[model samples]
Target: MTNPTSPRRHLPTSPFRTAAPPPAKRFAVGDRVSHDEFGLGRAISVEGDGTIAVLVDFGSRQERITAPFAKLFLL
Candidate 1:
């Protein structure tokens, strides 16, 4: 018999793991990009420094979004 409140056990495995189907790379500063939900816009800035950032466009009045470089596809 086991204690009902006992902590669950987990199998030992490699701590370091690689991401599957690595994210796509697109949209650099000065590059044009279009979002399915945000419509067309240009890459204003990238956040996370090494990850992604919120694209800004003054003409369309679109909001900024934090999207990963891999998830963003170049136009």
Candidate 2:
């Protein structure tokens, strides 16, 4: 049985090339970004090469956005 927490591997001979996952988003300090909730902001600080956490200044307030960055988009 396979563990539910483990990712399933794609078969080499499989024809489903579209099943490949997209690359993780990368960010850097001083980069412009937008968020679903925060509107617009600029990266103030980044943790662990921007994959861990990012500090952003959204003018009205600052937020510490975390990984996966679901609502965050690079600009």
Candidate 3:
């Protein structure tokens, strides 16, 4: 049974409505960069027509991180 005084339920939230931070644009392909967290790396690839993939060497290991060019600065 439903009560006439009961409050109405709200609709479920949508996940697609959320906004993402603008992509950074700093380096180009074949450019060198240094990250505070990743140390030193070189730009290997750019995808999504904006983001860049960096290959970093941390002495003991090498890793790759995709970030907007804006987040990285020219060295």
lDDT of each: 0.59, 0.93, 0.59
Sort order, TM-score high to low:
2, 1, 3
Candidate with the larger lDDT of 2 and 3: 2
Between which residue pairs do clashes occur in model 3? 24-68, 24-69, 24-70, 24-71, 25-69, 25-70, 26-69, 26-70
Q: Give residue 14's lDDT in candidate 3 (0 to 100).
A: 48
lDDT of 3 by residue, 4-64 (tens): 8997554558444445656566445677777776666666655554355655454566666
What lDDT does model 3 reach? 0.59
> Cα RMSD (Å) between model 1 and the true structure?
6.8
TM-score for all models, in order of appearance: 0.49, 0.76, 0.41
For candidate 1, lDDT tens digit of each residue in 1-75? 999999655446857554466654644566677666666677676666525565657365855566554344457
TM-score, predicted candidate 1 vs. hidden true structure: 0.49
Q: Residue 48 error for model 1, in Å?
A: 2.4
The runs of at least 3 residues in candidate 1 whose Cα sits more than 4 Å from the true structure, single-residue gaps closed, are: 1-19, 24-26, 68-72
